[model samples]
Target: ISFNAIDSALSSLKNCQSYINSGMDVATQVALDLVESFNDEEDVNNMEKVMLEYATMDRELNHYIKAFEETINQVKREKPENLPDLENLAQEKFLEMESKNSDLDFQRNEKYMYFKDQLKEMKKQYHGNDTIEEIDEDIAVTRSQMNFICPITQMTMKRPVRNKVCGHTYEEDAILEMIQTQKQKKKNVRCPKMGCSHVDVKGSDLVPDEALKRVIDSQKKQ
Candidate 1:
């Protein structure tokens, strides 16, 4: 399939996932309220299992879709058999299919195991106190951990530029100036992000993180 077709399908899958997750969230709130009003342990346990199954099913379907998309993109980029004489590359095609399947299996197994670990952690919760407030707290903490702010300026990045070498990001002007100052002095500036293994920043190593910039813009509007 064409890249546009693959992207459209992925978009649809993402929308479906969001729809399911919204419904699951509503159902969870209702379930929790019901359990609280009735104070029934059995119903709470059953409802939790149903919620887990529903979320897991949605996640699993999306994972397979993502794997398929990745495989197609890989095939286009790598072109396993681009020989002009070999018009019939059936064996090469089969090999690509096999590789895709292998990747799908590996990813599914790894994520499922991680999911089970999450379930175990949930089971360890003293009670179902992981409510909306708790969820909001978790979300906030997660966002704080994300690299939305530039390390150089200690501010929210307006134009985030990511280092290709170290996978860390900084504000575009700030990082460029840092690089320029070092180059003029005949020295290299290490990555600003603490504990980075990457030796130094190069002008070529920085690229605009357009995807992250969009996210930041959306959040600002919100």
Candidate 2:
């Protein structure tokens, strides 16, 4: 028979044989060595057989390192609104890997570490910053999902008022005071939220006095 026929027979035998049998141990061992040893087209036939069996014997043996990362991405895409839940998942997986990974030099071990560190940092940035949290909370409330982070500053905001449109809301009180000043000038002003420059006529009419009006308006806006 030709080398091709012999190669085909070996491939078939590798798949047909039971890996656990005692007599087949030597064959399995040789197949594994061949998988790692050969580096030519002629070796491809044997290599495929060896790899298929290895994968069949242990499905996760080659894919263990990527499991957590895949899981993280899956959760993030499927349920972005449940950021807290995602955060918990990240923490749980990170802790589990850290506790289990005594051998940091392993390729899978390093990947796990890297994934865990990234999750921790993202969680911290999401939770620690107040502005970001407020915006996230609002977005979560309205959209029932959270993806709003300042592109430039990475801050969470709620009804993020830009300075260019209606000036800025340096403080709730400051905004209130601005409304009072606008009223004094006979130019009714509205909340700067939503980038609108329009003064609030209903708001101006609601207050007993301009000073009290500003306070009530500020409270309503918040």
Candidate 3:
């Protein structure tokens, strides 16, 4: 599904590029015609105006081409097989952190509470009156936080896949493997997400989440 969407977007970008090239060609021809139309100094001024317009359009075209290339490269990089086993890596990290000291868990929880309080205070400071701009800003921040990491992997997702049943997202291969392993164990493949109420999740519940994948890619670039 995501591959098809990427292909469609690429095709559209190519068509737009071709159209821009054609427009530049037409502009160039018009500039040449203006050059031959008159010998007066006024003709020189007109030619200069045409040239400036052409330059502006050319810059815009180049910008779009560069953007398209970046998008294609991002999509290619987000292929599922290329992503690391973030779930296993995160588990290893957790085990190492725990083995070093049992107090680490308490410290982590305390830090989470401290940060949550700080965030609340900041939000109150910035959004005292709950104005439209403040509300929009808050929404944007919440959305960004949601897309920044995968719940199961506890890492920034490369190729995100959505669980349609519960509207949760995870790294594609991680979720698939989880589902397969759960199925082999002969247990209900419920969502592994904490606090999620979803049950009886199956492999078919997962879908390639292209929008989330793009968001992840964009966040990584930033």
Candidate 4:
């Protein structure tokens, strides 16, 4: 495929993602409406079921997008010239990529999960049967999902940055300040997360953790 074709394919994947996100937003709104508009158990259950069916579609579509992203990236990096080679390469890489991933990743996707949790609350309100036990379970699970506290600042991270080297995140300013301090001392800092083996921290190793930030923001709103 031509380079323009590759770029267009990637752009199409992005549009797919955007449409999925829009669907999620609409689902959340529908859940809200159902909560207020229905008191019948069967009706509410059916609406929730329909909502979940769309959610499943979203999950499957996202998986396809990820698989295609992996295939296209491999094709671009290798720069295969001919049609047969590109077709074979894409198929082989797609199977390899699909083998390494599953629907679970999309289920745990931050934006989707965030919308799901909101829908759950609306469901609870619609049913008017949220037991203390279930709420307790939700609290416990939410606590265990992620640690938003920055290792360097020991506070809830507002702008988290993750290290590409170790998959650990810290508050952006705090990590940058630490980096600046270490540079002034003509030395390097290790990844601050305990038990991490990354020996040196560099600015290039840190990237913005936008997904984590969105999760954190959603938690704060709750």
Candidate 5:
């Protein structure tokens, strides 16, 4: 039978006990007397068998009651008045993560810009006098300094991807495309002259002056 039916039966049996003790319910007294006689009899039935059944039922009833009580307590704990809105909590956490990401972006950009400016200045000062070897060495040093800044986002790259063609690596796709694409049909488009032998750094490398000029031209034409 169902738990509710069993519970109801047990309750009724308890009520019957009161009536039996008062000697008011003849029916309940007869039933009780018959059960007691089983224990008193020498050969009718074993008392141990009845006691084992009672113990097993009692344990099962205890488990059901404990389970029901736990469920009620859990419901109370999860009520609107007691618990916070999970969606709102998740939104707040997301905003917190975004703020942290933004802060990192800002700091990274600052460092990257500083190094880029320094490299540009060095390039301008040493323009056109050195042999291929010296120029390559200087370019290598400048590009190495750029490692401090992210090439794509102009932030300090946490995980930087280097360009196979040009030695210059950036985190942004726009910059990389500009560097890889030839500025004009006449000028040779290639990765940075850092002796890296990168054929074409289209992936994430910053576009050189040639690509920028072509972009400007394309924009003008449009």
Candidate 6:
């Protein structure tokens, strides 16, 4: 259960990071869009203010991600008996990440008001001038092809399950069957990966890795 909590925390952290990166990218593009609308000194000053706000938010998000990573690493090193305490710590960090996300949203809204006002003024000045052309900044993100493969079956994973203890991933049915087989022989269930340190793994040690599943689905579509 503690390992599951740790995995949950890790997933949350990754999600938060993805959000922060996307938000910052959008913020930067918005600033660029504003800058392209006019060349006036006042407009540039307003754009700088908006960019500064985003920069502050970016820094905060980076700090939070770093702190969360450190915390997870520390917890991973702790003994299995200490897992309950680790779960509590993970929950606290998740809450803190949510709070930071809220703070970033507030800052974004506040800065946007100034940005909107500046845009309005710019429109007045360049009413009939050539409109700014929208730049196509949508670059496709490339993922590792290996991520779609199941470590156990060495094929594309359907219904992927992530191992909470060692962060390895596998096909859900394959891992469950492995657990059951071990149980029937009255032996402890351990990770099948050679040289993997994880031991005494149970059915509860696995969780659905939704992110990986999404990636697999997307790749299939393409």
lDDT measured at residue 17 in model 3 versus the true structure, 0 to 100: 58
Residue-level lDDT of model 5, residues 1-222, one tens digit each, is 123653565566566444423432232223233432332333212322343333333333433444444444444566555554433554454444444443233223322223233323233333323322332232233432334354345554433344423445544544445654554443444543345555644443332332222223334567
State the lDDT of candidate 4 residue by residue for 1-222, as single tens digits. 556776687688778777767776666566555555655656645655665566666665565666666666776677666544545555665566656765565455544554444444444534445522343232112222356899888999999886756768899999999999999999989889888888799998776665466567767888
- Could you tell which candidate, 2 or 4, scores higher by TM-score? 4
Best-performing candidate as measured by TM-score? 4
lDDT agreement with native, every candidate: 0.58, 0.37, 0.52, 0.65, 0.38, 0.58
lDDT (10s digit) by residue, model 6, range 22-86: 65456544544555454564665565565556656555666555556666687667545545454
Per-residue C-alpha lDDT of model 3 across residues 54-101, encoded as one tens digit per residue:
444444444454554554555466755665444454445444544454
For all predicted structures, in order, the TM-scores are: 0.37, 0.17, 0.35, 0.48, 0.22, 0.36
What C-alpha lDDT, on a 0 to 100 scale, does residue 138 get in candidate 5? 24
Candidate 3 residue runs with Cα over 4 Å from true position: 1-145
Q: Which model is ahead, 1 or 5, in terms of TM-score?
A: 1
lDDT top scorer: 4
Candidate 3 lDDT at 192 equals 73
Off by over 4 Å in 4: 50-55, 79-84, 96-103, 130-222
lDDT of 1 at 166: 67
What is the full ranking by lDDT, best candidate first? 4, 1, 6, 3, 5, 2
Tell me how candidate 5 scores on lDDT.
0.38
Which residue runs does candidate 1 get wrong by more than 4 Å? 80-222
